[model samples]
Every structure is written in C-alpha cells, then in structure tokens.
Target: MEFAAVLLAAGASRRLGRPKQLLRRDGETLLRRGARLALASGAARTLVVLGARAEVLRGELDGLAVEIVLNPDWQDGMAASLAAAARALAGFDGAVLVLACDQPALELAHLHALRDGAAAAGCAATEHAGALGVPALIAPALWRDATDLRGDRGFGAGLAQAPDGAVWRLRAPELELDLDTPGDVDAAIARGWLDPA
Candidate 1:
C-alpha cells in the first residue's frame, strides 16, 4: 500500500535549552535524519513540519527529498504541527506515518515495518515502555481525528480515546530512546545509542 510520512519537528525544545531537532547523531541532525528515514521507507512523500527554527532547520534538510511545511502556530502545541501536516498531506490517498524528531535510535527498518504492518489497519502506533504512541501510521480515514487534536497533546490522545481495536500497536522498543533533554542525549551517547561524530 502507498503511504506518506510526516515528521513533527516544530517544538521549541524548552527543556533541552536548544533545538532538539538540531541534535546530531553521526553528523546528521535529528530532523534531517528522521526525514531521510521516512524518505527511504517506501513513503510516496515525506513532509517535515518546522516551526521553532524553521529557517535554520530548513538548511539542515538541505537537499533531502522531503517536503518542508512550516507551522506558524507551532507554539500552540504538537496538535498544531499535526494539523499542519494533515493539511499538507490532504491529497494523499493512503495512510500517513507520523514520527517525532527526537528519537535518536529510530531506524529506517522500523519505519518500514510500521508501514508494512499498517496495511489495512485503521492506525498503527509504536508500543514501547508499556505505552503506545507516535511513530504511528494513521490511515486517511483517521486524519480528521488527528487534525482535531488541540493543545500540547498529539494524535496519541486521540488514539487513547479510541475504542478497543481502533489502533494497532507495533512493538518497537527503539522508539523509547527519545532525546528530550541534554541528559537524555548524554545518556544515549554513553549508552552507544548514538554514533561518535
């Protein structure tokens, strides 16, 4: 099945004291790396939503084969970015895989598995650390719910409100390695989750 992908990278990174999207692993920023992973995972197109440092982050994307979408109301929350991405992918006929920019351990293979496993499923979310969340594939039928999200919450909120069997859980422990703070980045480096660059 054909699929599109959206990478949400519009947060201000207040906790990190810096743009987490700019965090690097092997010399590539998290945003760029996430976009590349999506592009290489059989997605028909990948749309990256930038807001906090749109201009600077755009440069990180450089020549990557992914569409850049700016979310002017990003400060409002992840929902804003999600809505912006939903609008940008309005014409897509299939599912849209949503991913965050802070997962330093995310790999193309995991994304490919999510896309493949999402075939005919209503939605497919990554199951990690005893929770189901992002790095999910939301079918076109569920885009309205995603766009309806508000505040700091993401589509995960909608997924949580869904009745049983509404969302498929794709077990992916790798997604649990999100870098939300400088300490997290340091731990990842110390744990060898990130390569020396």
Candidate 2:
C-alpha cells in the first residue's frame, strides 16, 4: 500500500550526552539509516521532524531528498514531533509508519506488516513493551487525531482508547529495542548497526 513514513529525529539524548540521531552506525548515521529504510520501503514521502541539535543532523540528511520539519517545541517530547509529522501528511492516504530515530535495528518487514494490517483498520501497531510501541500504520482517517497529539500523551494513548478489541498487534522484537542510553548504542553495534565503521 502507498503511504508516508514519519521519522522522529527530534529529542536530545541527555542520557547519551550526544544527539542519538547523529550517532554513526555502519557509516550511516541512525537518522540516515531510518530515513533510508522509510524511503526504500516505498513510502510516498518521508518527513523527518527535527528538534534540539537539528543542525547536526541536517548535514547527514543533506542529499536525502526528504521533507524536514523543525519542531521548536521538540524539547517538550516525542508528542510534539509526532504532531509536526502528522500535520505534514494531512492529505495523504494510507498510513504513516512512525519510527523512533534511535532504533536502527527496526526491520523494514516490521513496517510492512503494520502497513498491511492497517490497510483496513484505520490504525495498526507493532507489538512492543509486551503490547504496542510504534512502527504503526495509522490510516488517513485518523490524521486529525494523530496531528492533535499533545504533550507526552500520543497516538499510543489514543489507540488504547479504541473501544474493546479495536487494535491489531504485530509481534516484533526489534520494535522494542530503542537506543536511549550510551550502553544501548554500544549494544546495537553488535547487531551490525555500526558495521565495520
């Protein structure tokens, strides 16, 4: 199905003492890798939401040919970036696969599964944290709700409010692996995230 991908590049890695999105893994920085995946996955468009140190990431994404949105409120949290990206895809059909920049290991197949599932449900999410965490395929019907996401409360909370059994869950271990700490990035290196570089 045709769709867009929202890469969340906003957020300062206070724990890592550096911008996680700029962290290099196998020559390609996390932000670039994520954007490349979204693009390679056939996303109609890939909108990157940047915040805090957005300048550092700009160089890496220079020739990527992506739609970049600066989130001045990014320091506030992921919700702000989500809102920015949602607004970017307001008129697009299909769903938006929301990807956290820190997760370089998230497989493209995982996104495909969610997109396939969401082709009907208006919304579908990958299984993470024993439930759903992201890599979601949010159909256009819910664009308003997605763009209205506020504060730290986001689509995850909204999807949960689905009456009874309204959400489809896809099992994906990679979806749960998020690079939040220096140690996490170090661990990811073994997963071939850093490769020979």
Candidate 3:
C-alpha cells in the first residue's frame, strides 16, 4: 500500500518543561528519530507537522525525506496537528498513518503491521496504555473523520465511530512508552532507547 505517515510533533511539551522536539539523545532529536522511523517503515511519504518552536524544530529535520508542515493553531491542541496533516495528504489516495513523536520505542515492524492492517480493515490501531490509539492507520475514507476531531482529546471520537470490527487491532507493547516528561526521557535513556549523550 502507498500509505503516508503523518507525524504529529507540534505539541509545546509543557509538562516536560522544555521543547521535547529538540530533546536529544544519541545526538538525534526526538522528532527526527520519529520521522526516520516513519520513513524506514516503508511509508510512501512522511509528513511532519510542526508548531510551537516551528523554526527551531524544522532544523532537526535537515536532510530528512519527510515533508514539513506548519500548524499555526497547534496551541489549540492535537486536533489541529491532525487536521493539518490530513489536509496535506488530501490529494493522495492511500491511507494516512498518524504517529506521535514521543513514542521512542515505536519500530519499523509496528508501523508495517499498521499499514498492512489498515489496507485490510480500512483503519488500524494499536492497543496501548490501556486504550486504542496511534500509531494508527486511517484509510482515505476515514481521513475526514480525523479532520473532524477537536480539542486536546484528539482522535478518540474518530476511533469510536469506526464500524464494528472494522478497526484492526495490533498488539504493540512498546506503544505504552512515551516521552511526556523529564522522567520519561530518563527512563527511555536508561532503557537504551538511545545512547546517553
């Protein structure tokens, strides 16, 4: 399937008390690592939505193949980032895999499974942190549903509206880890997600 990965990296990272996008480990920023993973996953294209420190974050993506999109309303919340990415891929015919930049442990295999699942089920999501969420593959038919999501809550409503058994569920334990705060970053480092730098 010729799917695209939409990486949401616009958050301000208030809890982390710093710009998590620029947070480095092993000399690579978080956003850059996420984009690299998306590209390595075999997505036909990778689109990263940037907000907050957009200019600074853009620097992280230098030499990467991913497309960069700016979301001016990112302060409104994650829904804006989703909408921006969905809009960017509007002309494309394939599914859009929405990803969060904070998942340090997300791998190429997990993304490949989501794309394959989405190709079969119209939508594919992983069961993580006790809930259904990204890394999720949204079929073209369901892209509008993602655009309709509002507020900080994000794609919950869109997922809820999926037809019975229409959403493919993949087990991904790594999805449970995210870099939401300083301690989370520390844990990720201790786990060898990245070499200490």
lDDT of each: 0.83, 0.76, 0.83
Candidate 1 per-residue C-alpha lDDT over 1-197 given as tens digits, one digit per residue, 9 for 90 to 100: 77888999999899888888877788877888888888888888889999997888889988998999999999999889999988887767788888998888888878877776677467778987756778998877777667788898776666666678777787777678787787888878887666553
Q: Candidate 2 lDDT, tens digit per residue, 8-54?
A: 88888888887888777767788988888778767889898898888
lDDT assessment of candidate 2: 0.76
- Cα deviation in Å at residue 182, candidate 3? 1.9
lDDT of each residue in 83-133, candidate 3, tens digit only: 888788777888788888888777788888887887778888988765788
Give the candidates in order of lDDT, highest first.
3, 1, 2
Candidate 2 Cα errors over 4 Å, as ranges: 163-165, 195-197
* Candidate 3: 10-residue stretch with minimal lDDT: 153-162
Give candidate 3 misplaced runs (Cα > 4 Å).
Answer: 195-197
Instruction: Pull out the clashing pairs in model 1.
Output: none
Question: Counting only residues 3 or more apart in sequence or on different chains, how many pairs clash (N, Cα, C under 3 Å) in candidate 3?
Answer: 0
Candidate order by TM-score, decreasing, is 1, 3, 2
Clashes of 2: 1
| Whole-model alpha-carbon lDDT for candidate 1 | 0.83
What CA RMSD would you report for each candidate?
A: 1.8, 2.1, 1.7
